[model samples]
Target chain A: MTTEAPERRGARTESPAKFRGNPWSGRVSAIAYPAVFLLLVVLLWWGATSTGMAPPYILPSPEDTWAALSENGAYLALHTWVTAVETIIGFLIAAVVGVGMAVIMVYSRTLERTFYPIILFAQVIPKIAIAPLFIVWLGFGPEPKVLVAVLMAFFPIVIAGISGLRSVDPEALELASIMGGSRWKTFIKIRFPAALPELLSGLKVAATLAVTGAVVGEFVGANEGLGYVILQANGNLDTAMLFAALIIMSALGVLLFLILEVIERISIPWHASHRNKDA
Target chain B: MMTVETPSPSTAVETDTLVDVDDITIRFDSKKSSVVALRGVSLQIQQGEFIAIVGPSGCGKSTLLRAISGITSTTEGSVSLRGDQVVGPRQDVGFVFQRPALMPWRDVRRNILLQAEMRGMDRVEARERCEDLIQFTGLTGFEKSLPHQLSGGMQQRAALCRSLLHQPDVLLMDEPFGALDALTREKMNVEMQRMWRERDMTAALVTHSVAEAVYLATRVVVMGARPGHVVEEFTVNLPRERDYEETMEDPEFHRVAGRVRELLGSASSHE
Candidate 1:
């Protein structure tokens, strides 16, 4: 039994590591496979445009798009900065307000019942449809764009926050009380930390949506931002510039999402998702 | 109704009783129905004594433990600790749940020191005691490990250390080893026995295992289900320092274990 016990444990430990695959191979493939796929996509686009299967007016060639990107780099950079700043500001506001609302709702049934339906009603309305109205109400500056971004980002954060805050193990709360911890103390020491994994996941979704929200708002009324760049390029039939703007805009979203992923890894290293990756 | 066995000479005195549970009843009321968890259940725990309450599943063994900790309120009677009514959670009691319930983010040492952090104990003294406990529980090497990194038994050891950090007078455990494998469970039982003796703390363990109750407790309280109440009790005459293998084979262990099993079997048969 003694010898068998060690053997079983050794197998149990080794099997999971083996099943997860070699870390170096996994890491290399994770990047390599995506890069290969993207290269194929770029090649396909190049072939389509070069062969004239698709015209430059509708779908610009890869070279035309790349030239557009470099030639107008300074101009695109400015608009991208404007949109990125608006998105970031909106996302931050949504995060704070959404988490605050969730905490209040978790603590007070009255507030939850009162605000839940209204929040749900707001979520059902497409922000794109209401973007014009925000432009009308807040008038042509960053306020309307920021508001749209906040609205877009708010729902997921609130939902995730509510679930996260409520996800604490009941026994942990009992342990807190048994140790003479106050309600506030339990919230700070247990509930908040426990909620971080879910809350961060919500923030990740919000980060991407905030970019979309800002662009949509800009589309409605702005004379600046990547949305404006797309609008002007489309009107003048500058397909390459349009493609350039679209690519940079998506890059911004991906960048924000990646930042959140890094934050999630740092903040909740003990979380199952992060720990499993390490194993 | 409850029946107490002949008490040992040390546990006989009223003043020596650290926990006095007087005919407490716990009821759970839902929107549709009210379930009686405990009906007029009563038990007393003496200072520095190990009392194991064994019963079938749903026999209010856990409810009784929670009531003693004052986390669950008794609908009918009262629970007193050291002559003071336990109106709310008392400061001098530590509880170990079935699950380790350690904060996943905290390492073993921080998880154990959580008790001190909550109670506002002096940081320097608490860390000193925390190291001692980590060593005592054989978790010295894994002090920096997170809950997920440790095995089930090690996680539970961290939990045990967490509960003991405050040095509570009474330690209430609710099926703490139920999740472990048989070998680990037996090893933990031996460690638990040693920890209890070394700390000289009053402990009440709730388990469904008859042999575990017999092996650990100075006294065993057998309870029945369906509006749970204590049916019988047994006083183990074994010495405080009991070897796991010898105690399992001893005739005294068998006699008490057999009787307790018989009582539990009959009680569950009625259900």
Candidate 2:
């Protein structure tokens, strides 16, 4: 069995292009399809506004939205930075606290039973409903915004962390025990690394939610941010500015998500989702 | 029928006996009911012995192996290694499961070195031993490859290398090759025999294949289910370094294999 056929073994070692599961043609289509779809959507938007089918006040032209973006580039950049900082900070906090809580709960059934239901209850309550309460408590500073982002991002991380940490193979645990590994060693060496694929997936979801959270927090009470810009634009009927702000907000979320995907690739390249098709 | 005398508890603790499972019983309890997995099961393994346990699916053979490794506790009686009572997992034994159980994030070399890391062995020595085992198992070129990159047979070989990296005094395997195809399994059994002959180690394998038990083990233990216990034992009078085809064609091998099948047939029929 070990002496595999020379050709098969050579294919695995050299990984010739012809044998790759995902060929260059497949990859080209993967990117091309999405790009073409986006182009068509933009064209449709241009047609809608250019023909007066949609009024400027209701739906701004693509050119007008672009002009608004570049004109207020500096101002929008500042607000985007503010929102970005809040989202990143909140995500970091939630990542640490959520995973820590999950580890504790997994190790102790008593804690799991005690805290799991409460967490689920907290998650079920709409976070937006409590944004106003956060404003009252933390005042209109970025603290409230960051806190709301943390709340929005916390639940998925906790849920994913719990399941990921608990998803270790029983045989692996038995092997650890036979090696005389301490609980701490087993967790650090086995449970933690094994959980990365799931945990990172949760982070991707939380990244987008973090943006929504910060924006929602700004909506209730804030002096500056993309959310504040959108509100001001709405009051002035500057539909172009409103569209620009919404675009930037989504771009920020995608940027964060892409950064996480890069981290996931670096951290666990051996994961099925990250592994090269040839490998 | 062949009859083999059961070793008494006093004799089980003799210095030459590497592992002594002294009349152990295991039971699982739940909210609704209790299931007895093993009852009054005892076996003594001498130094440098290969013992294969064969039984039906629910016969608790795997449970018995786990009990010896101290991963599962016996409800009654005790297991001792070298005159010392087995309390928790001992550091000197190695275990292989049905699946390779390699860390998906780690490459073959690092996966095998996981044992050395856990035991805090000397880094240089561990690396050298890891290299040697990789070469010995015909995984020399694939050291840098991840577990997912390897074939099922190759993965199992890597697992075997990981188990043997520490040069453990005893190796316990629970259906290690049961997942492989027939040809691959036969090839692995041959390799396993070679590895065992080269090393001065005791091994206990739990498997469902009667031919496998007869092929690889010096002593084949047949167990019965529904409160599993030993029904009979067969001693294989074959050469230590067994060739795959030669052993399969040997009359003695066929005789042992046929008897084991008969015993298993009767054992399951009783259920």
Candidate 3:
């Protein structure tokens, strides 16, 4: 039994280190693989365009796309800024409403039973299908786009928030009660902090969805934003301009995701997901 | 040395009792049926006494602990702490669960000081007590460390420190060291005994381990399963200053442990 115990422990401990490798070398390889893959993809695209295997009008050469981007740089930047503002505003509204609703639901089972199904049903309604309706109700401007973004981002936040709120260790709650911790005190100190990890994950999902929602709104009715630019480029058959607009939109999405990641790292260093990053 | 007055049999004992549980019955009503966890259970704990309750699983050991803390309401009878009926959770009674149950976000010091924070005690005094608790639990160096950073044993120690922060009159523990490894559990038993001996506190520990009950408790209560009730109580006649090496070798320890184990075995066999 003595020999068997050490052998079992050794087996359990050894595999993970072999798989993860040393931190320094692992970091280098992590960067190297992604960079190499990106370079190869760009090379293939350049080769396809340069060799005339793909038509310029269909998939414009990287240089043509770059030229289009530079020529209309100010216009694209303005649209990007408008879209970003709409996304941020919508995201803030969704977070407030979503978390508030979650708190109410978690606090009252009757409310949860009544509203949870309705929320789920609302989530299933295609936001894009209702985009035109939102435009008709609100307007052909940032308001419609912001509303759409909120609608898109609301469900995940509420679901995750509820799960997080309920996930507080029961023993912790009991301990608080025994310590004479008030309901508000328990909610603020124990429940909120514990729920943050799940809430942040929900927020991260919403961040990227916010961008898509804004662009969808712009596609339906807005006179500005990357979505409007894409529509115009498509109509004029300016593929390079369309490509440029698409690139900016994707960059916006990635930028929002990265920003949320940074916020998550700051807010929840105790979370297991951020442990390796802190290390 | 004092004059002996006419001592009433009931009042004298009642005044000395820190915790008086009188035939408390706990029933859980599910949709399908009613489950009786505890039936007509009575135990009176005096001040500065350490009582260990040992029983089979589903014997309502945890239920009784919760009853004392006022976390669970009894279906019948009453539980009184210091002669006052326990209606709901009270700050004067500290409770330790099977698991350490430390807050993940808070560090050792903050977690220990949580009781003080909840009660809105003086900040300076709370800090002093927090520091003393860290020292008492030998968690001085890891005050700022989060719960996950500590080992099972260390976290349990931090939890022990947290429960004792308010200097509660009675400490109710429900298998606090059940989650630890065997070696660590044994070590923690000695540590807990030492703490209990040093402090003027009433404690009740519920555990499934007969040996642990025999080792640490002043009185060991053997409980039966299925409508849990106290079957027998053994007063540990061993010396107070117990060491692992010496205590385990004591014949009285063996006798008490043997009796408790046999009681538990029979209790389960009847079920």
Best by lDDT: 1
User: Pairs clashing in candidate 3?
Assistant: none
After best superposition, candidate 1 residue B218: deviation in angstroms? 0.8
Tens digit of per-residue lDDT, candidate 2, span A1-279 = 256531113334456454665667667887899999999999999999999999999999999999999999999999999999999999999888888988899889999999999988878888789999999999999999999898889899998998898888888888888777788899989999998888999999999999998999999999999889999999999999999999999999999999998999899898878655433
TM-score value, chain A, candidate 1 = 0.94
Predicted candidate 1 versus true structure: per-residue lDDT over A1-279, tens digit per residue: 112221123343466787776667767887899999999999999999999999999999999999999999899999999999999999999999999999999999999999999999888999999999999999999999999999999999999999999999999999999888778888988999999999999999999999999999999999999999999999999999999999999999999999999999999998988755634
lDDT of 3 by residue, A24-60 (tens): 7767877898999988988899999999999998999
Give the winner by DockQ: 2 or 3: 2
The total of clashing pairs for model 2 equals 0
- Cα RMSD for candidates in order: 2.4, 2.7, 5.2
Which prediction has more favorable TM-score, 1 or 3?
1
Go through the candidates in order and give each one's C-alpha lDDT.
Answer: 0.90, 0.87, 0.86
DockQ for each candidate? 0.52, 0.56, 0.37
Q: What DockQ does predicted model 2 obtain?
A: 0.56
- The candidates, ranked best first by lDDT, are 1, 2, 3
> Candidate 2: lDDT of A22?
60
Q: Write the per-residue lDDT of candidate 1 for residues B18-95, one digit (tens) a residue.
A: 899998999999999999999998788888889999999998999999999888888999999988998887778989
Clash pairs of candidate 2?
none
